[model samples]
Structure formats: structure tokens, C-alpha cells
Target: MNKENLFDTEDILSEGGVRDLFEEVEVGEGEKIVKQGDAGTDLFIVDSGQCVVIDDKGAGRIIDSLDRGDVFGEMAFLGGELRSATVRSNTPCKLLKLSREPFVRFLRKQAVPGTKFLIFLERFMVERLRKADSLRVLISGDQDLSGKRGLQQLRADIRARNTKPLLSADDPILSEICHWIYARNDQVLFREGERTTDLFIIRKGEVVVVDEGAGGFLLGTFGANDAVGEKCFLDGKPRSDTAKVRGNAEILMFTRDTLVELLERDSSMAIGLSLGLGSLLARRLSMANRTLRLLTYEELREKAEVSRLLSEMRKSLRIKTLH
Candidate 1:
């Protein structure tokens, strides 16, 4: 069977530039654009030519590739982690590069196009993350992990994940437009593949995302101030994971239409809200990448161990007369 590239990107962007917020950098063929474990938090867009994403662990392997308009280096750009993969230029290329510091300043200076760009990035990142998680589950299915509740993600501290609170205590969305929800424990907020456009922020209590297909594989557990389904809020795609209440919880819901209306009425708040969504999605995507890397390494080791044992067993089964 063909190996599916888990990093499926949303092909919604092909602009000359995102309001000229990015700087163009030239690269030559076979040049390593970004290296794994490097301390770089800058994102790059394939302006022209191609590049390959390589997992620089052990013997190393190619994870994916990028062409015009595709994004790379975002795992570190959003997650504040070291570069997770090495990107090498396949051809002499021109890349549009932007870091968080300048991206924020551009958003403030030109809110309209900047907001649109931020919204696009947030949605794109969500799609990218969904593909990564989808592949993770598929890989786990290869081995009978029936009793294994989850992959290495379970050991990670939920409160200290790459996801950050989308808003603070004084955000206006909490006051004017949010639909307050008081949910009971074990209540399902939303299910995977459901068509819903509601975005939820946990006001008090915990929310957990689960993959019911894997016999309740825990995707993530989010605490107060974290967003449960921010992706559904922007992209009209079906929900990727089911969100359930862990306890009696208070959730603030916002409809995309309502947010659009509010942004139209008061453009001043656009930069803050839109950028916040971008940052939140960036961190979530970063976490997903890290999880993917961990899962990949574990799977590799498991396969190597099985091969070694099989070889030993074969040797032991040889006829004594042969010796």
C-alpha cells in the first residue's frame, strides 16, 4: 500500500504575497532551508520552486514536500520548539519568510488583509494538524494496541501542551457576544464528522477531545481558557474530533457569523481576535507535529525489535545436522 503523506495541507492560498508581510529569500538546490533540532521560529512559504521535509533522526527519511504557496517551518514558528524536520531545497528557489515578531507588527499596521491572512493560516494549520493526527491513529492501528489507551501523548502534561489560552480574563468576546453554556459531566459538546460552526472556549472546567473510532483514544484534554473547537469556528469543514465535558463546565460559544459581524462593526478588535486565533492554532499544530515525531520514532524501534527477534528465531529453528 502507498504510504499516505500525513501532512495534507489546505490548498487555499496562492497569493503574490500576504500584503507584503514576508521577505523573499533565495536558496539553491540541495540547500538545507531548515534543520531538525535547530532553534528557529521563522515560517517560510514556497514562493517558487520545491523543497523536501526530512526527519533527521537516525538514518533520516523524507516526511513530505512543498511547492509554491505551501508552508514549512511552522512547527517551530508556532510551537516555540526546535525545528522538527529538515527542509532542503529541491531546486533553486525563492521563499517568502516571516517570523512572529514582524507578523504581529504587520497585523497591527494593516488589519484588513492581515486579518484575512491570519484567518487563512489558522484554518490551514487546523487542516494540517487533523491530517497528522489521522495518520498517527492509522499507524497505531498497524499493531494491535487494543489495551494501549494511547500513544506517547498520554504521558504529556495536558496543562503544559503546545496549546495556549486563546483569550485572557478581560476579553470582550466573554462579555458581549458569547453564548454561555453550562454543561454536565460527560456531555458531548460535538462529535467527529458533524457539521457545526460553533467555536467554544472553556470558561471553567475541563474539555477532552477523543477519537471514538480507536475505542476512545484520547486526543487531548483541554483546561480552562483553552479552545476546544476553534477550527470549526473558521473552516466550515466537519469537526475532526469529538469534544466532551469532563466535569460540570462553563463554555463560551461564538458563531462565525456573529464574529464576522462584530469584526465588521468594530475593526479595532480585529487584529487582537484574529491574531489570537492564529497563535492558538499555530501552537496546536506544533504540538501535533511533536506528537507525530514521537510516534514515528517509537514505531521505528518496535519494527527493528521485531525484525531482530524474527532473525534469531529463524536461526534457532535450523536443523542440528546442518551444524
Candidate 2:
């Protein structure tokens, strides 16, 4: 098997890069590197020996194996949540670890590269989710239900009635993956920091995005055809913001299993989907960068408050380290 490079020589040549940030650590055989449900802020990359990723739910099934260059603990590191799985060294292992604060600092200093890194990480996470979902399908012996007549009936109805259908009737890839859901007013679709495998598209009514870090602010209201949960779904992390229905609503849900199956059958469709999502990510990142270029007075005040919070957090971390 080919090994993965954590950082290229060019990246290492740059001052204060990821190569300079990670610290080396050694683990004995049968040692647990990370425990499921424990909050983790560091990401680890295996340098040598072997490790195993095990899901602790119901008798501890082994999800995957990690050899040289494999990375773990990234989901919790990126989402600021508890670990989803346990990683244990199968043999004496050499590892490189990078903590959250330094990673954030590196990103701040290297904006363009950092954005590309995030995209790479998102792609990696998506592959991992697909593998997990596919494994579940194999173990359960579940049949693919995409050939159901109900979906064809729904597609026909959408074509005749809806002027702007979320997926075209001819798009078999999407047709196989999408299913309808109903939601009532004030119903929570998903809460912040909750892990989920499904993505949604609103077919009717609206939903509000509530972000607590922004002081319970309603970031925006999304209406028909708007996609929610895609960002975290793509990144394989917990939801970053809470989504609640504003009124009676119809939604279309898509699962990672369907997408993986689609890719297995048709590679071109997968490429097209990735390209479309990649462009959306690029536009969103550009807009965010533009917003950071100019801040209002209130925005400036909020920024200062964020800095103050970070200061307090650093002090708390220091105290913990001392003890």
C-alpha cells in the first residue's frame, strides 16, 4: 500500500508550518490513543507500526485499520466534540500529534493553503463515512430499495406539479438517494454538535439556523430547495449550527450509503457532484474572506469579545496543564 505524506518538503520549508507544529509521540502495543466519548482537541498521524479503529457500540466492531501515515482523531478535532470511535495501537507505534490551537493558528497565518487543506480534509472525511456506511449495509444484508415504485411515483408527481424540482426526473443517481420527510413548526431537524449521516433539502416551508456562539442569533432563514447539513455531512463531523423548522415543511433526505453506491456504479456522476459541491465551497469561502476584509463597529466589538474568550480559555488550559 502507498503511504500518505502529511506535509510536502515545500510546506516544511515554510516557517511555522504544519511540519513545525506537530510533536512526536510513542505508544506501546495495545495502548488506547483515544477513547470514544472523550473530548479531544488533538489530531494524530501514525508514523510507524499499526493501529485499529473500533466502534464501541454493541460489542466493539473494528471499523478500520491504520498503518503508517494514517490519521485519526480529526472528527473531534474539527467539530469540537467528543470522539466518535476508539483508536488503539495494535503494535508499538510512532505518531505525530498536532493540537487544536496551533492548527488554528497555522490556518490563520496561511489562509489560501489552509482553505485547500480544509477541502482535502472534507474529502477524506467523506470517504471514511462512505466506508462506514457501506460496511453497515454489508453486515445488515439490506437490499437497495431504490427500485421501489413509490420513488417513481414521487418523481412523476414532482415533474407534473413542481416547477423547480430539487432533482431532475432523469437524474437516476439522485433519484436513488433521495427520500421525502415531514416536519412541523419548531421541530428541530438537528442540534449543534449532534453527529448525523443524513443531508436534507427543503421542498416546502422554511427553517431557521440558530447559532449559539453568535448569541442565539438566527443566522438566516432557508426556504424551498435550500440544502442543510451538507457541510457537516461532507466533513463527517457534528453539526455546527442548529436547524429548526419554521412551519409545516416537506424535506428530501439523502444518505451517505446512496452516494457511495452511486459512485460505485457511475464514476462520472460522482465527479460531477464533487465539482458542483467544490464550486459552492469556493464561493462560500470567497464570501467569508470578503466579509472579513471589512468589519462594522459592532463586528469589531464582537471580535474583541471573541479574543477575550480565547484568552480566558488559554488560561484555563494552562491551569489544567499545571495541575
Candidate 3:
């Protein structure tokens, strides 16, 4: 049974914000903390002592041990699903509980700690999803294994087409982060002002990025190894451009949440991705600067100034390779 605390105690404890939000409780040995099939909306962190997580669906198997700093009940709170496992104390325990409402309130009030907590929380769910999916594949046997291998190959093909840093075909986690999409000719992937969470990599064929304003202008046509929807995705805003398939196309999608998880796991990969995005942004800025040539001298000077700022911006992103 794979179970580990996804959050660091130091990170959580750094601000009294989250700690202050939690209500403390003391429990005697053999006390049930969370029951299977219960409508659980709160999360628990063990302050001291031990607990056992039992998978009630399968002969009540003991899945993992919980100790001080260990957290449980998060999956239910996050997914708004029934508790799949029952957690009970093995020894007298001290615990801190956080309900969903208060946690949300804290997040709205305390941005820094809230951001850190959410990052840890997202990573936790990603890990759990990975393990659960792996277990499902394993139990399904050779047929599923063969299917997964084909999917892995597809993931690799899309990864090769990504504008970002090269991800190894052997990186099993990348398969989880990237999703494949197929579109027919003239398909509209997304429209301007639509709220979307995905950044797209064109694996085959082409995509035209269109900006709507002044009768809708085409920003550029992107082919294999090019990414789109990044500006809005990274800025946490609605899509500013529409993506239309120029022909039948294959794409790999990276949702913002999963990309954050990937970056958390691999700093080198994060640096590589940042460099790639920086390069792309620089090219766009240069192109935008060139478009100013049609304007008057003052307008062109403004564009030139903006281009200079962009150049400085790219230089500011110092890349450091990890050992």
C-alpha cells in the first residue's frame, strides 16, 4: 500500500493561517475517525499517535498507517465523493480537522499559504490517481498492458511534437499528463473569451490561432511541435484567441493543473519548459514589433520600446541546470 503525506509539515506550519483554521480533537485508541461510505466533507491531519486506513470494499484490508503529520479524508473532500476507506486510531491520537467551507474561506483570505496548500493538495490527488490507475491496469492483465503500451507510444509521439522541453518516452508520468485529441479539417478547438484550462501541442497537421477584434485577424498558423492557448492558460484568464484546425489534426493537451504537478515533480523539466515558452513569447513579441512598421513613427517607437522590454524580460529568466 503506497501512502505518504503529500504535504510538508513545515510548509503547512509556516503560516498559522491553515493551522488556525483547523479544529483539534483528541481520540482514544480504537476510535474511528472516518467511516467508509460516509458523507465526508472535512480533512484530517494527525498531530500525534497512529491510525490504520482500512479498505472496506475488499475484505477490510489495511491499506496504510497514519501517524503524526499524516493526512487523510482529503480525497473525499476534494472529489466530493464517499469515503472509500475507513480510518481508525490504533493508539490515543491528537488530530486537526479542516472542513471544506473554512478551507475555502482561508484560501480567499490568505493567498500565499492557500496557494502552497492547493499545490500540495493537487499533487496529492495526482499521486493517488496515478497509483489507482496503475493498480487497475495491473489487475486487468496482459490485454490492458498491450493497450497501455500503444497509448504510451501515442503519448511519446505527441511529446515529440510539443514545443516545450523534450520529455523522455520512458517517462511514464508524461503519459498521465498528456491527453490525445483528433480533429477533422476546419474544426474549432477553442473560441476566444472561452474559459479553457488546456494548452495544446499540435502533433500533426496545422492549427490557426485567431484573435477577434477589428473583424477577427489570424495571429499565426502553428504546425507540428508548436503549442497554443498558453498565454491565457498561464495567466489564469479566459482564452484570448480561437484555435481552428487547418486540416485533420492530432493534438496533445496539457491541462494547467497537471502541468503544475509535472513541474512540482521535475525542476529540470520545469526549467526546460520555461525556456521553451520564453523563446516562443520572444518570437511573438518580435513579430508584433514588426507589425508596427505599418504605423506612424510614434506608434512604431512604442512597439520598439515594447520589444526592448520583452528582450529584457527574456534575459531576466536565468536558466540554471540541475545537478
> Cα RMSDs of all predictions?
11.9, 19.8, 22.0
Q: Estimated TM-score per prediction?
A: 0.75, 0.42, 0.46
Give the per-residue lDDT of model 2 (tens digit) for 76-194: 56545467678899999998888877766666555334433444545554443333222222222333434533534433432333234334425765666667778999988888888
For model 1 the local lDDT of residue 115 reads 60
Candidate lDDT values, in order: 0.65, 0.56, 0.58
Q: Pick the candidate with the highest TM-score.
A: 1
- Cα lDDT tens digits for candidate 1, 140-244: 667554454444444354355634455453566557766778999999999998999788888789899989877777777888767778877777788878999
Listed per model in order, the count of residue pairs whose N, CA or C atoms clash below 3 Å is 0, 0, 0
Tens digit of per-residue lDDT, candidate 3, span 1-323: 00122223235555546668889999999999999879867888888888988768648877578777777776555545466568999999998788977776665555445545654554444333223322222233322234333434433443344454333434677677677789888888888789875778676788987656424555567887677776654544576568899879888777766555765666445434443553344334323323322222333224544444333322211001100
Error of 2 at 165 (Å): 25
The order by descending lDDT is 1, 3, 2
The prediction achieving the highest lDDT against the true structure is 1
Q: Rank the candidates by TM-score, best first.
A: 1, 3, 2
Q: How many residue-pair clashes does candidate 3 contain? A: 0
Q: Which window of ten consecutive residues has the lowest lDDT sum in model 2?
A: 314-323
Model 1 ranges off by over 4 Å? 1-17, 142-158, 161-164, 169-173, 265-270, 296-323
